[model samples]
Target: MTPAQRRRAAEQAARRLARTSLFRRARHLALYLSHGSELDTGPLLRCCHAAGKAVYVPRVLDGQRLRFERLVEDMPMQRNRYGIREPALRGARRGAARMDLVLLPLSAFDTQGHRLGAGGGYYDRAFAARRSGGPRLVGYAYALQQAAALPAEPWDVRLDAVVTEKSLHVFRN
Candidate 1:
Protein backbone atom coordinates (compact mmCIF):
# COMPACT_ATOMS: atom_id res chain seq x y z
CA MET A 1 0.00 0.00 0.00
CA THR A 2 1.05 3.60 -0.49
CA PRO A 3 2.40 5.56 2.47
CA ALA A 4 -0.67 7.79 2.48
CA GLN A 5 -3.04 4.87 2.79
CA ARG A 6 -0.88 3.34 5.48
CA ARG A 7 -0.87 6.61 7.44
CA ARG A 8 -4.65 7.02 7.32
CA ALA A 9 -5.16 3.48 8.56
CA ALA A 10 -2.63 3.89 11.33
CA GLU A 11 -4.11 7.16 12.49
CA GLN A 12 -7.57 5.65 12.70
CA ALA A 13 -6.12 2.72 14.62
CA ALA A 14 -4.31 4.99 17.06
CA ARG A 15 -7.42 7.06 17.58
CA ARG A 16 -9.35 3.94 18.48
CA LEU A 17 -6.69 2.89 20.96
CA ALA A 18 -6.51 6.39 22.41
CA ARG A 19 -10.19 6.18 23.18
CA THR A 20 -9.86 2.86 24.95
CA SER A 21 -9.86 2.61 28.73
CA LEU A 22 -6.59 0.71 28.72
CA PHE A 23 -4.68 3.45 26.90
CA ARG A 24 -6.43 6.15 28.85
CA ARG A 25 -4.98 4.77 32.05
CA ALA A 26 -1.47 5.74 31.08
CA ARG A 27 -0.24 8.75 33.01
CA HIS A 28 3.00 9.30 31.20
CA LEU A 29 3.39 8.53 27.55
CA ALA A 30 6.33 8.52 25.16
CA LEU A 31 4.92 9.41 21.77
CA TYR A 32 6.75 10.08 18.55
CA LEU A 33 5.70 13.13 16.60
CA SER A 34 4.91 12.12 13.02
CA HIS A 35 6.98 13.11 10.04
CA GLY A 36 6.31 12.94 6.34
CA SER A 37 4.67 9.78 5.08
CA GLU A 38 4.35 8.44 8.62
CA LEU A 39 1.13 7.95 10.51
CA ASP A 40 -0.53 11.19 11.58
CA THR A 41 -0.19 11.62 15.34
CA GLY A 42 -1.28 15.23 15.87
CA PRO A 43 -4.65 14.27 17.27
CA LEU A 44 -3.14 11.60 19.45
CA LEU A 45 -0.61 14.03 20.90
CA ARG A 46 -3.24 16.62 21.59
CA CYS A 47 -5.46 14.04 23.21
CA CYS A 48 -2.60 12.95 25.44
CA HIS A 49 -1.74 16.49 26.54
CA ALA A 50 -5.40 17.30 27.13
CA ALA A 51 -5.77 14.13 29.17
CA GLY A 52 -2.97 15.40 31.47
CA LYS A 53 -0.38 12.76 30.61
CA ALA A 54 3.18 14.00 30.42
CA VAL A 55 4.16 13.66 26.79
CA TYR A 56 7.69 12.81 25.70
CA VAL A 57 8.79 13.18 22.10
CA PRO A 58 11.91 11.87 20.38
CA ARG A 59 14.73 14.04 19.02
CA VAL A 60 16.97 12.47 16.40
CA LEU A 61 20.66 12.82 17.13
CA ASP A 62 24.07 12.25 15.57
CA GLY A 63 24.37 8.58 16.44
CA GLN A 64 21.29 7.46 14.60
CA ARG A 65 19.68 7.30 18.03
CA LEU A 66 16.82 9.02 19.82
CA ARG A 67 16.58 10.95 23.05
CA PHE A 68 13.36 11.63 24.85
CA GLU A 69 12.54 15.31 25.17
CA ARG A 70 9.58 16.68 26.97
CA LEU A 71 7.17 18.11 24.43
CA VAL A 72 5.63 21.46 25.16
CA GLU A 73 3.20 23.30 22.95
CA ASP A 74 5.46 26.33 22.72
CA MET A 75 8.53 24.53 21.51
CA PRO A 76 10.02 25.60 18.17
CA MET A 77 9.74 23.16 15.27
CA GLN A 78 11.67 22.68 12.07
CA ARG A 79 11.55 20.23 9.22
CA ASN A 80 14.27 17.67 8.77
CA ARG A 81 15.54 16.24 5.51
CA TYR A 82 12.67 13.81 5.43
CA GLY A 83 10.22 16.72 5.82
CA ILE A 84 9.07 15.59 9.25
CA ARG A 85 8.38 18.13 11.92
CA GLU A 86 10.66 18.02 14.98
CA PRO A 87 11.44 20.20 17.90
CA ALA A 88 14.67 22.13 17.90
CA LEU A 89 17.18 20.91 20.47
CA ARG A 90 20.21 22.67 21.95
CA GLY A 91 21.74 19.38 23.04
CA ALA A 92 21.01 15.70 23.25
CA ARG A 93 18.23 15.05 25.75
CA ARG A 94 18.92 12.49 28.44
CA GLY A 95 17.48 9.66 30.55
CA ALA A 96 14.47 7.40 30.21
CA ALA A 97 11.75 8.13 32.68
CA ARG A 98 9.19 5.55 33.73
CA MET A 99 6.70 5.81 30.92
CA ASP A 100 3.37 4.16 31.35
CA LEU A 101 3.08 3.66 27.61
CA VAL A 102 4.76 4.39 24.28
CA LEU A 103 3.49 4.87 20.76
CA LEU A 104 5.90 3.94 17.97
CA PRO A 105 5.51 4.74 14.29
CA LEU A 106 6.49 2.11 11.78
CA SER A 107 6.89 1.65 8.06
CA ALA A 108 5.93 -1.96 8.34
CA PHE A 109 5.23 -4.74 10.83
CA ASP A 110 4.67 -8.47 10.77
CA THR A 111 2.40 -10.81 12.72
CA GLN A 112 5.49 -12.06 14.52
CA GLY A 113 5.85 -8.57 16.11
CA HIS A 114 8.89 -7.43 14.19
CA ARG A 115 9.12 -3.81 12.94
CA LEU A 116 10.50 -2.64 9.65
CA GLY A 117 11.85 0.87 9.98
CA ALA A 118 12.63 3.23 7.09
CA GLY A 119 16.15 1.72 6.75
CA GLY A 120 17.92 4.17 9.07
CA GLY A 121 18.03 1.53 11.84
CA TYR A 122 17.59 4.38 14.32
CA TYR A 123 14.64 2.97 16.24
CA ASP A 124 16.01 -0.57 16.10
CA ARG A 125 19.38 0.42 17.54
CA ALA A 126 17.97 2.76 20.18
CA PHE A 127 15.45 0.20 21.39
CA ALA A 128 18.29 -2.33 21.71
CA ALA A 129 20.34 0.04 23.86
CA ARG A 130 17.49 1.26 26.06
CA ARG A 131 17.94 -0.30 29.51
CA SER A 132 15.79 1.92 31.62
CA GLY A 133 12.44 0.78 32.95
CA GLY A 134 10.22 2.93 30.83
CA PRO A 135 7.16 2.27 28.74
CA ARG A 136 6.85 -0.97 26.82
CA LEU A 137 7.16 -0.87 23.03
CA VAL A 138 3.89 -0.63 21.17
CA GLY A 139 4.07 -0.15 17.43
CA TYR A 140 1.49 2.16 15.86
CA ALA A 141 0.66 1.43 12.29
CA TYR A 142 -2.08 1.34 9.68
CA ALA A 143 -3.41 -2.11 8.96
CA LEU A 144 -1.97 -1.84 5.49
CA GLN A 145 1.56 -1.74 6.88
CA GLN A 146 1.06 -5.24 8.17
CA ALA A 147 3.12 -7.85 6.43
CA ALA A 148 2.85 -11.62 6.62
CA ALA A 149 6.40 -11.68 7.98
CA LEU A 150 9.44 -9.46 8.38
CA PRO A 151 13.10 -10.35 8.31
CA ALA A 152 14.56 -9.88 11.76
CA GLU A 153 18.29 -9.38 12.10
CA PRO A 154 20.30 -9.89 15.26
CA TRP A 155 20.08 -6.21 16.16
CA ASP A 156 16.43 -5.87 15.27
CA VAL A 157 14.27 -5.59 18.33
CA ARG A 158 10.70 -6.84 18.65
CA LEU A 159 7.69 -4.98 20.00
CA ASP A 160 5.64 -5.88 23.06
CA ALA A 161 2.50 -4.98 21.19
CA VAL A 162 1.16 -3.46 17.99
CA VAL A 163 -2.00 -1.44 17.51
CA THR A 164 -3.60 -1.05 14.14
CA GLU A 165 -6.83 0.77 13.31
CA LYS A 166 -8.65 -2.54 13.09
CA SER A 167 -7.41 -4.07 16.39
CA LEU A 168 -4.95 -4.01 19.21
CA HIS A 169 -2.44 -6.88 18.86
CA VAL A 170 -0.30 -7.90 21.79
CA PHE A 171 2.74 -10.17 21.63
CA ARG A 172 3.74 -12.54 24.42
CA ASN A 173 7.48 -12.37 23.84
Candidate 2:
Protein backbone atom coordinates (compact mmCIF):
# COMPACT_ATOMS: atom_id res chain seq x y z
CA MET A 1 0.00 0.00 0.00
CA THR A 2 1.09 3.50 -0.66
CA PRO A 3 1.57 6.00 2.14
CA ALA A 4 -1.83 7.54 1.49
CA GLN A 5 -3.54 4.17 1.42
CA ARG A 6 -1.96 3.20 4.68
CA ARG A 7 -3.06 6.41 6.32
CA ARG A 8 -6.64 5.99 5.15
CA ALA A 9 -6.81 2.39 6.22
CA ALA A 10 -5.40 3.21 9.62
CA GLU A 11 -8.00 5.91 10.08
CA GLN A 12 -10.79 3.55 9.15
CA ALA A 13 -9.55 0.85 11.47
CA ALA A 14 -9.17 3.34 14.27
CA ARG A 15 -12.78 4.36 13.83
CA ARG A 16 -13.90 0.75 14.06
CA LEU A 17 -11.89 0.32 17.25
CA ALA A 18 -13.30 3.51 18.75
CA ARG A 19 -16.82 2.17 18.32
CA THR A 20 -16.19 -1.07 20.13
CA SER A 21 -17.61 -1.38 23.65
CA LEU A 22 -14.31 -2.88 24.73
CA PHE A 23 -12.53 0.25 23.69
CA ARG A 24 -15.18 2.58 25.06
CA ARG A 25 -15.11 0.99 28.47
CA ALA A 26 -11.36 0.81 28.61
CA ARG A 27 -9.71 3.32 30.95
CA HIS A 28 -6.22 1.95 30.51
CA LEU A 29 -5.08 0.73 27.10
CA ALA A 30 -1.89 -0.46 25.42
CA LEU A 31 -1.00 0.53 21.84
CA TYR A 32 2.11 -0.03 19.79
CA LEU A 33 3.64 2.50 17.48
CA SER A 34 3.73 1.48 13.83
CA HIS A 35 6.91 -0.06 12.52
CA GLY A 36 7.63 -0.58 8.84
CA SER A 37 4.43 -1.28 6.90
CA GLU A 38 2.32 -2.04 9.95
CA LEU A 39 -0.93 -0.26 10.47
CA ASP A 40 -0.35 3.08 12.11
CA THR A 41 -1.59 3.69 15.65
CA GLY A 42 -1.27 7.47 15.62
CA PRO A 43 -4.99 7.96 15.05
CA LEU A 44 -5.91 5.47 17.73
CA LEU A 45 -3.50 7.05 20.16
CA ARG A 46 -5.06 10.43 19.54
CA CYS A 47 -8.50 8.98 20.03
CA CYS A 48 -7.51 7.45 23.36
CA HIS A 49 -5.98 10.68 24.54
CA ALA A 50 -9.03 12.64 23.45
CA ALA A 51 -11.25 10.26 25.40
CA GLY A 52 -9.18 10.74 28.56
CA LYS A 53 -7.84 7.19 28.55
CA ALA A 54 -4.47 6.23 29.94
CA VAL A 55 -2.34 4.84 27.10
CA TYR A 56 0.74 2.65 27.42
CA VAL A 57 3.31 1.38 24.90
CA PRO A 58 5.42 -1.71 25.07
CA ARG A 59 9.08 -1.47 26.05
CA VAL A 60 11.49 -4.35 25.72
CA LEU A 61 13.05 -5.51 28.95
CA ASP A 62 16.30 -7.49 29.26
CA GLY A 63 15.97 -8.16 25.49
CA GLN A 64 13.54 -10.94 26.19
CA ARG A 65 10.40 -9.52 27.80
CA LEU A 66 8.05 -6.60 27.45
CA ARG A 67 6.84 -4.10 30.04
CA PHE A 68 4.40 -1.35 29.17
CA GLU A 69 5.16 2.25 30.03
CA ARG A 70 2.66 5.08 30.16
CA LEU A 71 2.79 7.33 27.13
CA VAL A 72 3.13 10.97 28.07
CA GLU A 73 2.90 13.97 25.79
CA ASP A 74 6.25 14.84 24.22
CA MET A 75 7.92 11.92 25.93
CA PRO A 76 11.37 11.13 24.62
CA MET A 77 11.41 8.20 22.22
CA GLN A 78 14.09 5.80 21.10
CA ARG A 79 14.11 2.89 18.67
CA ASN A 80 14.36 -0.59 20.04
CA ARG A 81 16.61 -3.30 18.67
CA TYR A 82 13.84 -4.11 16.18
CA GLY A 83 13.54 -0.47 15.19
CA ILE A 84 10.27 0.00 17.02
CA ARG A 85 9.84 3.35 18.74
CA GLU A 86 9.20 3.30 22.48
CA PRO A 87 9.21 5.83 25.26
CA ALA A 88 12.77 6.64 26.26
CA LEU A 89 12.09 7.68 29.80
CA ARG A 90 11.30 4.79 32.10
CA GLY A 91 8.29 5.69 34.19
CA ALA A 92 5.58 3.76 35.97
CA ARG A 93 5.06 0.50 34.10
CA ARG A 94 2.25 -2.04 34.06
CA GLY A 95 1.87 -5.62 33.02
CA ALA A 96 -0.72 -6.76 30.50
CA ALA A 97 -2.96 -7.87 33.36
CA ARG A 98 -3.43 -4.28 34.43
CA MET A 99 -4.59 -2.92 31.11
CA ASP A 100 -8.23 -2.86 30.13
CA LEU A 101 -7.34 -3.34 26.50
CA VAL A 102 -4.25 -4.04 24.42
CA LEU A 103 -3.99 -3.44 20.66
CA LEU A 104 -1.26 -5.68 19.31
CA PRO A 105 0.65 -5.54 16.04
CA LEU A 106 0.66 -8.56 13.80
CA SER A 107 2.16 -9.73 10.53
CA ALA A 108 -0.72 -12.08 9.86
CA PHE A 109 -3.73 -13.44 11.77
CA ASP A 110 -6.59 -15.85 11.42
CA THR A 111 -10.23 -15.83 12.46
CA GLN A 112 -9.25 -18.19 15.25
CA GLY A 113 -7.47 -15.28 16.98
CA HIS A 114 -4.03 -16.72 16.40
CA ARG A 115 -1.57 -14.04 15.37
CA LEU A 116 1.83 -14.20 13.73
CA GLY A 117 3.93 -11.49 15.25
CA ALA A 118 7.39 -10.48 14.08
CA GLY A 119 8.66 -13.93 15.08
CA GLY A 120 9.18 -12.68 18.61
CA GLY A 121 7.18 -13.96 21.57
CA TYR A 122 7.13 -10.66 23.39
CA TYR A 123 3.35 -10.19 23.39
CA ASP A 124 2.69 -13.87 23.86
CA ARG A 125 4.99 -14.06 26.89
CA ALA A 126 3.71 -10.79 28.30
CA PHE A 127 0.10 -11.89 28.29
CA ALA A 128 0.59 -15.60 28.62
CA ALA A 129 -0.80 -15.70 32.16
CA ARG A 130 -4.11 -14.31 30.89
CA ARG A 131 -6.22 -17.08 29.50
CA SER A 132 -9.90 -16.48 30.19
CA GLY A 133 -10.01 -13.04 31.78
CA GLY A 134 -7.96 -9.91 32.15
CA PRO A 135 -7.14 -7.33 29.53
CA ARG A 136 -8.85 -7.64 26.17
CA LEU A 137 -6.14 -8.62 23.68
CA VAL A 138 -6.95 -7.15 20.29
CA GLY A 139 -5.02 -7.20 17.04
CA TYR A 140 -4.75 -4.01 15.03
CA ALA A 141 -4.09 -4.63 11.37
CA TYR A 142 -5.26 -4.02 7.84
CA ALA A 143 -7.90 -6.26 6.32
CA LEU A 144 -5.42 -7.84 3.98
CA GLN A 145 -3.44 -9.27 6.86
CA GLN A 146 -6.15 -11.78 7.71
CA ALA A 147 -5.35 -15.37 6.83
CA ALA A 148 -7.51 -18.47 6.56
CA ALA A 149 -5.72 -20.07 9.52
CA LEU A 150 -2.48 -19.86 11.34
CA PRO A 151 -0.51 -22.30 13.44
CA ALA A 152 -0.53 -21.90 17.21
CA GLU A 153 1.52 -23.27 20.04
CA PRO A 154 0.86 -24.00 23.69
CA TRP A 155 2.25 -20.67 24.84
CA ASP A 156 0.50 -18.57 22.20
CA VAL A 157 -2.01 -16.09 23.57
CA ARG A 158 -5.20 -15.65 21.60
CA LEU A 159 -6.74 -12.32 20.82
CA ASP A 160 -10.24 -11.41 21.91
CA ALA A 161 -10.83 -9.45 18.75
CA VAL A 162 -9.17 -7.99 15.66
CA VAL A 163 -10.00 -4.68 14.04
CA THR A 164 -9.22 -4.12 10.39
CA GLU A 165 -9.97 -1.31 8.05
CA LYS A 166 -13.03 -3.11 6.71
CA SER A 167 -14.53 -4.37 9.97
CA LEU A 168 -14.02 -5.91 13.39
CA HIS A 169 -13.77 -9.64 14.04
CA VAL A 170 -14.43 -10.88 17.57
CA PHE A 171 -13.04 -14.31 18.17
CA ARG A 172 -13.97 -14.67 21.83
CA ASN A 173 -15.19 -12.80 24.85
**Index of the highest-lDDT prediction:** 2
Worst 10 residues of 1 by lDDT: 89-98
Which pairs clash inside model 2?
none
What C-alpha lDDT do the candidate models reach, one value each?
Answer: 0.75, 0.92
Question: TM-score for model 2?
Answer: 0.97
Clashes of each: 2, 0
Expressed as tens digits, the lDDT of each residue in 57-171 for candidate 2 is 9999998899999998899999988899999889888878989999999999998999999988999889878856589999999999999999999889988899999999998
lDDT per residue for candidate 1 within 1-173, as digits (tens), equals 67676656756876787877657888767788777666678767877877887777777778476777777788888866666667776433435435677788888998888999878887676667655455578888777789999989988878878887788888866
Query: For model 1, what is the alpha-carbon lDDT of residue 54?
Result: 76
Worst ten in a row by lDDT for model 2: 124-133
Q: What lDDT does candidate 1 reach at residue 56?
A: 78
Off by over 4 Å in 1: 1-11, 20-22, 89-94, 129-134
